[model samples]
Target: MFVLIWATFLLCVCAETGLSQKPRVKIPTLTEGQQATLTCVAPGLCSGSAPEITWTWRGAGGTESYITGSSTSFRTKTLTAFTQRHISTLTFNSSAEHHNTNVTCKIRFTGEKITEGGSTLKVNYVKEVNITGGTNVKEGETLNLTCSVESFPPSLIMWSKLGSDITLHNDTGSATLSIINATTGHSGQYVCTAKHMNNTLQENINITVIYIRTPQIIGNTIIKEGDVLNLTCSVESFPPSLIMWSKLGSDIILHNDTGSATLYIINGTTGHSGQYVCTAKHMNNTLQENINITVMYIRTPQITGNTIIKEGDVLNLTCSVESFPPAVIMWRDLSSKTNSKDTGAYTDLQNDSGSATLVIQNVTAEDSGQYTCTATHPDTTVTSSVSVIVSWFSKIQDVSECVLQAEVLTCVCISEGFPLPTIKWPLLGNHKEYAIKTTVSNHTVNSTVSLKVKNHGNSTVECVSNNEKGEAKKNLMIRSVSDTVADSSVLNVGYLEIIIAFLIGVVLSAVVCCLIKKCSRKKTKNSGNLDETLEMVTSQDDPQVFMFIWLFFFFLHNYKVFNCAQISSLLKYTYLVFWFSI
Candidate 1:
């Protein structure tokens, strides 16, 4: 009983002492490079309890430790959670990264419970780090780096770039260091440090940022129509770049020599003259560049000339022009002389550069005029001229023998001369009835004249041919028809004989008819009067005797009929006869 009472008295004293002193919780022991936590617990403290807790540092190098919340001189920094919490906690991952660190916990109790503790960390695991991905990155690209190490219960991970701290995404076993939308400024070596349970590991990755995808010039930038043209297409890439030539906006191959991003053009033409671009591909990135090409060709040709020409002279014409495939030569005469009205002769020659020539044969005075030579090619036409001169006109020769009336007349003269000749009658004044006629041949252009005159005494007539140079005349004779009729006569002696015969016949017939009629009448009357008829006969006896005498004379001379000139002689003869007969 005496020993129990003595223990009770000792316990009471100890309790009082505990209440007077600040309570401190024991900080756990931690290994180097390992994650750990130091807790300061005041046992039996309620939510209303207020305590002042402080953390102190004790270095592993045997230096003096740092303290806070006490009047003691120390090199220590008080953490934020320790200033107000009655139970203080230092939550951290223990690693080799902190192998030389020392930690201490102190508390000032506002209530009855208080605790104080201190600890030192010692790292143990072998430190290692691994950078799983490449260190190099492109500008404006995603940057991801994984840092991992063999650790227990995971590790505390950190990322840094060029000496700057960077946020890290950490999982249970690995940590990833990343930069979203990184640029050229973000290019450098990156370090990933991981702290595991009492172990520390680090990984350093070298990054060489490069511009692998670059602009390129693809295919031939300059091309021609007929021949090959060289084009240069250059690009920058990690490997060789892919360059191609295409028409505007199309994917079809524009050139054949597709090289490994270099200058190449197999066969080029105007069709290949368009936009060409190059595609530079590296990894998953691509770039492009463009170029343009144009084609050229030759133009057409031209010609010129004159229009007037002469007969006996040289004719010269020309045709000249320009073209792509070299111009062709042609000479055509668009005139009646050449016979070709439209298209002309084509003269093909090796020397087709400038102009072609056309010549005419020996010319005449009739040919003295303009001659046109037309030169025509594929797309154009031109004209030229030739001049000629001649000496004189053509020739003509011939005449016909002609007959004219019995009058002054002229013969036609047909002949040829240089400038043509005129004709006239030379004997015009000698015969008034003579006239002349002149005619010209339509086809021969020769002049001929015929002359005529009166048939008086002229024996011949003359025709003259004259011109500016000289004159020649020819003669023709004429006969007269009126001179033969001037000395002709006729006589009439048969008319007297026919008249005497007719008068005798008429007188005999009349006497016979009268005697017959008178005898018939007397016979009828004397039948009754014979005596009266005897007396009438005796009285007529004297008339009968006279008739007898006249009859005898008419018979002796035979009855004659005479004209008026014989009538007087006949009467005188009648009276002499009467006397003679008596």
Candidate 2:
């Protein structure tokens, strides 16, 4: 009974001692490459002896071993007379390999009492940020990317595209960025940012989205005729799209290029006005766009009328033109040389759809001028003219007479008409040797004929004037040479006197022309003879000679303007009178 009580008392005391002396471990926050200290404290209930403390480690692979490369210190102290404590501190460099590892603190007392405490090790550590995914993706396909880093206590990661303010994804573990139906607009550089403890890290990746845009046509749909038709077709795409321009109904391609194409229709006409299509082909897709073009134009005016109308007849003319827009028509007399529409007092003007008509009642000689019809449209103006001629005949003047001078018969006849009447002498048709001349002014015409006659003629002495409208005739009365001597048609000089004056004038004219030719040749030091008769000098070396030549040509060119049929006749009328007066 005494041994049993002694054993029971010892067991109770040991239980209390064991409960009070359990080893305690204190672990603070740890980081890689930082000096770390782990402390194990024991109760100080036992006052007789100190406790032996040691450290041990268990790795992530479940391997266990005694801790190495660490310094440990043991210290004992008494808080009071009845209380005592022991402390064992272990110091080592913190590393990433220590993360999630198990460390234990063991204490062995003098009475063979063993006690231990432990905690799982934790270290704050993070590596460089990383992004994983393919950077090149097709349009309308999914874009999958992951941003992550190896870290203790898992770092916060975020995914963002460069130049964007919004974060695409964020996570405490791997950050995943998922985009459905990606487009070319989504192409750019992406960044992955990792924040771990006191460190922030970033990594970059480039992505490209390939796609094709809708084809578009650029140009004016409405153009004027004869203007160049310019148009362009283009598309936005990767793997450059092929662009082609073609007319709507034709299979021929007008232009072909990559990404863009230009079509040209030079001097485009009404035939070129139609619909055009722009086609774009990329990868496996085909796109098209169409545009309608119209070419506006107008044609020249056409005039129809009777240009030659008889006197007292009605004149009618019509002007018409073909154009897209109806035209404004006007009838005008071009004689005024003005743009304002002006018609004669006796004229009627009427305008209809695309045409104008002009009518004149009782057309007369004054109406024998150019009459024009003008057609004007907003785009252009066209004009057409017609020459109108009024025909009429008047009788020959009764003053017509025949004179016999030195056995030569001379006759004079005059006629007046519109479309100037033509005079014919049946008497001259029988005589081959005759000099004839005709003069016309306004609506009057004068014809004269001279022939030698020794005796009475077998044919009648008649003058006839006629035209497409009517005819006029007169029989000239023959008179003795002495009786018609005062007639103004011939000079009233004696035959011998007339002959002498003509010879003298011819000699004088010849001498003057020869002297001028000789003088011009001498001035130029030319050896040519005076063979160049009365012709003007063409040499530009002498101003005086040029002036003289100019005047001579002027006179020679103007002499025919008057009724001076022959040089002899002029001298005969004037020189004779001068000689007799002198």
- Measured against the true structure, the TM-scores of the candidates, in listed sequence, are 0.30, 0.44
- Looking at candidate 2, the ten consecutive residues that score lowest on lDDT are 339-348
Q: What value does the lDDT take at residue 142 in candidate 2?
A: 94
Candidate 2 lDDT score relative to the true structure: 0.77
Please identify model 1 stretches exceeding 4 Å from their true place: 1-310, 322-329, 335-354, 365-444, 452-582
Q: How good is model 2 by TM-score?
A: 0.44
For every candidate in turn, the CA RMSD to the true structure comes to 29.4, 14.4
Q: What lDDT tens digits, residue by residue, belong to model 1 across residues 94-191?
A: 56545546666665545445556555555454446767876676767888788777554467777776576655455546777667787666667777
Which prediction has the highest lDDT against the true structure?
2
lDDT score at residue 516, model 2, on the 0-100 scale: 59
Superposing every Cα of model 2 onto the true structure, what RMSD results? 14.4
Question: In terms of TM-score, which candidate is strongest?
Answer: 2
lDDT for each residue of candidate 2 in 1-582, tens digit (9 for 90 to 100) = 996676566556644775675677999899988989999887544454677888889987788885567788999877655446788998988888888899988888776878888888998888778888989889999999998899987989998889887899899968999999999878999999898878889999999897888888888877778899999888999878999989898999889999999999899898888889999998888999888888867788899888887889998888888765568887777553333445433232465658888888998777778877777777677877788888887668887777776777888888888767889988877676666667788898888877777786543479999976689888888876675455655533346545545655555465446555655433333366644444345445446644754454356438763333443354445455445444
Query: What value does the lDDT take at residue 208 in candidate 2?
Result: 88
